[model samples]
Target: MASAKPKFPAIKPGGSLILAWQVKGKHVVVVGGGEVAAGRIVHCLNADAVVTVVCPTSGLNPEVAFRVSEGQVKHTDRNFEQSDLDDADMVLVAIDDPAASTAIWKLCKERRIPANIADVPPECDFYFGSVHRDGPLQIMVSTNGKGPRLAASIRKFIAKQLPSNAGNAINSIGNLRVKLRSIAPDPAESRKRMAWMTKVSDTFSWEEMCKLTDEDMDFLLRYYPENKAPSFSELRIAQGAPDPQGVDPFDGSFGFSVGA
Candidate 1:
């Protein structure tokens, strides 16, 4: 029998490998001056890249143009040049002319430089994601260049649902780990302690624990009946809770600061 036709494309274009780049002290070339280019330029600047705009027009953004005037960026109001890609670790081409943009993309590929072409998915190496940052915590949503609007809508939804205390909660939990290591320097002892702490975490929320002062913390550890985690049955009773069927009593998702 003849081989059945392949049911689908061997590889889909939508699969993305996400990563964060260290752009500090790196050269980033932006090759357009339109509003889109302006946004791209700002992103590069925020990442601490040494940015240069190579759009030969008044279309270059005011903020970037102003920065160029102040000697922050190199601006060549001219056509794309091979030299523009020199020393550029990342390139973004935002020009209106397809031929020019394509040429720039080809050159970037030849030099193995990372690149993005505004609104032209096929010609681009990567698509930007809608990102929300809280200190070191970040939530990024992407559409794999399929529907940026949908990705943005999802990001808005996520932003609304994210807890305001997320950063503080993470910090408190991290500090507890440091304390655990100091208290149990032996590897096996640390693991045993960590297992106990993990059980405690299942019962107590960071918010409740964080409310305790340093003195309270010391008292709880040093004087509070052997630093023992409460038995699950005891926890269930103390929580005014129902039967757990010998599993977690809660039917919903919980965080580090749960039950308390």
Candidate 2:
């Protein structure tokens, strides 16, 4: 039989493709210790990257200096050297010296390593979008280096519209999924679990999902194979929650959904 033909049109090439890069345990060399560099270092550290900051002691900002003093980041008390990029998985240049920054960008190009030269969109291989983080959930808004302020405003708006317990809901669901996997380890059980989880998701509101406890997860594990998993509302009622009243906070009618 012939394979299915493509249904969608080819994408036009204008916007940048957003991605969640995994940099955990990777080495990120940041050249400069100014405020911008300090912010960049924090972002890298948040992702569990090994970070090195290179700059003269005089150039160190208070934020960077504090981290360096506590030995959170390795600091080279001098200008950037070519050897700084030796084991670097990525580089971020935040110095005011145009010549030095450009030279580093060129070296990164030669080594085919991704680099971001602060405030220089053309010299950067990646752009840092305004990020809104909630536990394991992250929403990033980017304008492809055009308008950072606008991107930040948009991210703020997006964040404001989400339910406060959104992250908790995600965490509970994730744990439930882990329990489901353990209960149904067979590969053939994949579809069955997926359908059950989807049903549970569609049936429960985010607030209801967030209230799920280990007992709820245990109940799911026991009944998932039997295709009789209980709705989260039932579990909540059993736990003395008043009968659910009013509209769900996440019913896609709270001015949050596209074209709502």
Candidate 3:
């Protein structure tokens, strides 16, 4: 017997546009209580948004209950209400009830609020992309509502390539920039000095960069370009290896009919 083939779509996602919303001190509302809703609530909390979950109380997931207990989220023990969306920066409707979810979507549209509905891409005003966050560095990946699991797998790959001390390494380099500005205020000369800073920073391991004191950073800024590259005794030290983990790139093994 021959295997069935896949159908390809001629059209693709429109394009990629990226923006970071400043959610700190803002309110975010989620209208569901299951795993999907709980996941969105956690993301809002991470962004420092005051989160409120509005749904029937009896079906709340364990994660939601835990977040409420920890004071990270507020739970309103009732169905979603339009008034709940007041002052909201964003809304997520994860419930399966199409009529209710549609009502929420219309309300958000009227209020000009960005909204996302789990498992229902056509109704979404935006998507929750896979996010890789390191202290001040954030990478967001989106497959344009096509393959969220694939997006998540790619995010894990990119995030793992960064050194563990990346945050501190960036701070060390930043301080050097400030010092250069103080010493060489002239624009053209400062550009050349900035190039040297970039080159010297690229030569060291992020761990070694983090270990450098302000004195070491100053030394590098002073003698770099004139001096040869720093020795790798500290820079090249192998801090042992990390445990390997299997990576799954595919979304699923479950069988579903395309012509159903």
Instruction: Name the candidate, 1 or 2, with the larger lDDT value.
Output: 2
| lDDT for each residue of candidate 1 in 1-260, tens digit (9 for 90 to 100) | 99989888687565798888789999999988777877787777767888888976576677767777887777888877999888999999887888888888899999999999887888778888887766556777988777888998999898788677555555555665666666657886756776766765765665554443343333333211244554434344334456555445343322222223
Per-residue lDDT, model 3, residue 108, is 91
> Which runs in model 3 stand beyond 4 Å of their true positions?
1-13, 174-213, 221-260
TM-score of each: 0.64, 0.84, 0.68
RMSD of each: 8.5, 7.6, 15.7
The model with the greatest lDDT is 2
> Which stretches of model 1 miss by more than 4 angstroms?
1-14, 66-77, 171-260
By TM-score rank, best first, the candidates go 2, 3, 1
lDDT tens per residue, model 2, 165-205: 67888998999888888867899979998998887787777
Worst 10 residues of 3 by lDDT: 251-260
Q: Look at candidate 3 and give me any clashing residue pairs.
A: none
* Local distance difference test, each candidate: 0.70, 0.83, 0.74
Higher-TM-score candidate of 1 and 2: 2
